[model samples]
Target: MLSSYLTLAAILFCIGLYGTLAKRNAIIVLLSLELMLNAVNLNLIAFSKYGAIPSLTGQLFSIFTITVAAAEAAIAVAILIALFRARGTVLVDAFNRMRR
Candidate 1:
């Protein structure tokens, strides 16, 4: 059971990583980041449930991760909105010109 959960989490993480690295859209990138975070959370929960010590530490950490992910999403969305307003585009490649 633990192995299955870990396998699923691994698959999810890979998909999220691919989406984050390959997507052109900022929104999709942010969503992919969230997906990656969720995969981490899933792993944490699974370990918490299956570990020999059997404490709540993993779950507690997962909760904290979720809180951080929520805050990150909110901040990312705000930045994306501002960026879109300024440039009329949400493509990652377009952001490169901002360095100049």
Candidate 2:
């Protein structure tokens, strides 16, 4: 069962990695990052449940990660919105120039 959870997390992480690397849109990239964070949380919970000396450490860490992820997503979205307003586009490639 632990192995299964790990496998699922790994698959999710891979999908998220692919999305982050291959997607052209900033919004997709942010979503992919969130997916990856979720994978980490899944792994943490699985380990905490299956470990010999089970404790609340893994869950606590996961909560911390979730909070950080939420804050990061908020900031990233704000920046994306600002960029879209200034540049009229949200494609990652369009951000390369860095100059109006």
Candidate 3:
């Protein structure tokens, strides 16, 4: 069961990584990043459930990770919105310049 969970997480992480690296849209990239984070959370939960001397530490860490991911998404979206307003585009490649 743990192996299955780990396999699934690995697949998700790979897909997320590909999206992050291959997509041109900033939104897609952000979504991919979230997916990757979720995979990490899954692995943590799986290990917590299956590891010797199973404990809640992994779950606690997963919760913390989720909180951080939420904050990151909110801030990233805000920044992307501002950038779109200024640059009229959300392409990751077009964001090379930090300032006009």
**Candidate 1 lDDT trough over 10 residues, lowest sum:** 46-55
lDDT of 2: 0.96
Which residue runs does candidate 1 get wrong by more than 4 Å? 98-100
Q: Against the true structure, what is each candidate's TM-score?
A: 0.95, 0.94, 0.94
Clashes of each: 0, 0, 0
Instruction: Report residue 71 deviation for candidate 3 (angstroms).
Output: 0.5
Model 2 error, position 38 (Å): 0.2
Local error of candidate 1 at 44, Å?
A: 0.4
RMSD, every candidate, angstroms: 1.1, 1.7, 1.7
CA lDDT, every model vs. true structure: 0.96, 0.96, 0.97
Per-residue accuracy of model 2 over 1-100 as CA lDDT, tens digit each: 9999999999999999999999999999999999999999999999999977788999999999999999999999999999999999999989977576
Superposition-based RMSD of candidate 3 using all C-alpha atoms, in angstroms: 1.7
Task: Look at candidate 1 and tell me the lDDT of residue 19.
Answer: 99
Q: What is the C-alpha lDDT profile of model 1 across 30-97, one tens digit per residue?
A: 99999999999999999999977777999999999999999999999999999999999999999987
Clashes in predicted model 3 = 0
